[model samples]
Target: MMPLRTIANRVECEIEIKKSRFVGVVDRAATEADARAVIAAARMSDPAAGHHCSAFIVDSSAGDPLADPKQQRIERSHDDGEPSGTAGMPMLEVLRGHHTTNVVAVVSRYFGGTKLGTGGLARAYGSAVSEALVHARFLTRQRREIMTLELDHAEVGRVESELRRHAVLVLGTSYAARAVLTVSAVDADSTAALVASLTAGRVTPVRSGHMYAEIPD
Candidate 1:
């Protein structure tokens, strides 16, 4: 699967444009419902603000087996009483230009007895979100195949060390009469090959499913 970029954590920034205060809040939103929740949270953050504009892009293929993982991107924008295309469109454009996905941005506007015309409002709102994103941390995520390897306790340490040396991400490990390890790899074939080589054909790995794993931005 293709790598996706999103905010590492929630971030907020405030900007003053022509005496009007614009507060921008950005967060990772993996679905439409998540985006709405973030919007609601933004509204609650500044109840007195006159306008709350929002934009989001979510991966529509998530949890869907037949969907085109990378091509199925969902985008939404809301002006929230600002001029038709002023607030939300520009915010959405900024996100698209940055190649960010599964994220939402909301800009709350508090009028300060001054009006920024259509163009001014667009620039202000867009800039507010852009500035917030600039200061925010980001993460890259990709779909990985999950597998479990069960082996004798004596082999656990050596196999795990070798897997780590090969850059495989070991999710967790459990102990019983044997050691059961949960790991994730970019593909199932690579995981099988690694397990076979590590155990010299004495152990077989079981495939579980796919999960989104975070990687460095």
Candidate 2:
């Protein structure tokens, strides 16, 4: 699967329309429980807010909260107390258009004694999320196989430099009787080959596991 895009940190944006205040919060959430937790935090931050609408999309490659393997993606939206289809649906559409995954958005409304009609509410909610996203930092998430290589301390600096020259991502290194280096790569075999060549067939890498890593977007 191709790498997915998500926010690097939580962000909030606010807008006022017809005296009604709308505040939007955006964050990365890998599961339904995480999304709910984010919503709860947003509500706690603004206890006096009238409505808290929410939307989210989870990638299937990550653990599926719904436990449906057939569904590669999960999506949900809530209108809160706003008119039907006005608050949540538009916010969800913005996420879809951006091709974002593992993301959740919540819009909190503080009534200002004036009511916006359904159309106005939808635009306001959508705009709130859109503006928040504009200020958010994005990251690309991809699955990579992790490998560990053990070598004599003498070979550590040379091997590490060669690995960087080949664009290998070095996660960390530990100094022990033998130096142990942890790395991640898109292709394990290719990474092993590179390491072997760099060490002149004196070192080999063992597969540890797989995990997702964030890359600059």
Candidate 3:
């Protein structure tokens, strides 16, 4: 299976290169809209910053980023008027090098009195992101389908235990007239097989939607 990774949480850091201040932030963002929101928040926080350059990559397990990153992922970058290829492209390259998905990075630059050429600007912006990533926490997740399995009170305890023992993630549980377990499986066929074996064909699960959830490190 293709491994998918994401940020554990948001991170913020600052670095100074040649007297220029670079403030960088990284966060988990699965969509273009989410990435834009993060970029907007950074701009709002530092309205006076000289430039706010940003990059993002959003992908799924179905496609291999290494084979064709641009085609496989929603990849984008913006220099934010610093130069043609100095700020944004370098930040985007750093993210791609990290092989992380569903994440966004933004670097706000406050220029110092001195001027650094294009190469210097690129290095500063990229290093800013790299510095922030030093404090980032990462986690692996995979695509999983949600399912609901209802059982009488008597069967709930044993059935749920068996489900966990088999590595099925129990998303939620509710009890009323009966017990309903919202669980996750890799796919419907495997889920059906597991449920049949667990309940001896007496129960069927209703398929819901899909989601991404953490796996062991």
**If both were scored by lDDT, which would come out higher, candidate 1 or candidate 3?**
1
Q: State residue 3's C-alpha deviation in candidate 1, in Å.
A: 2.5
Q: By TM-score, highest first, what's the ranking?
A: 1, 2, 3
Q: Per-residue alpha-carbon lDDT of model 1 for 136-212, expressed as tens digits?
A: 78777677777899999998999999888877789999999889998878867876887898888888889888777
What local distance difference test score does each model get? 0.86, 0.86, 0.84
- Give lDDT tens digits, candidate 2, residues 125-215: 9999999999988887666788899999998898888888777789999998999999888789998999888888988899988766667
Per-prediction tally of clashes? 0, 0, 0
lDDT of 3 by residue, 9-58 (tens): 89989998778899999999867788999999999999999899999887
Superposed model 2: Cα runs more than 4 Å off: 58-74, 112-115, 150-153, 172-180, 187-190, 202-209
Return the top candidate by TM-score. 1
Clashing pairs in 1: none
Question: RMSD in Å for candidate 3, one decimal?
Answer: 5.1
The global Cα lDDT (0 to 1) of model 3 is 0.84
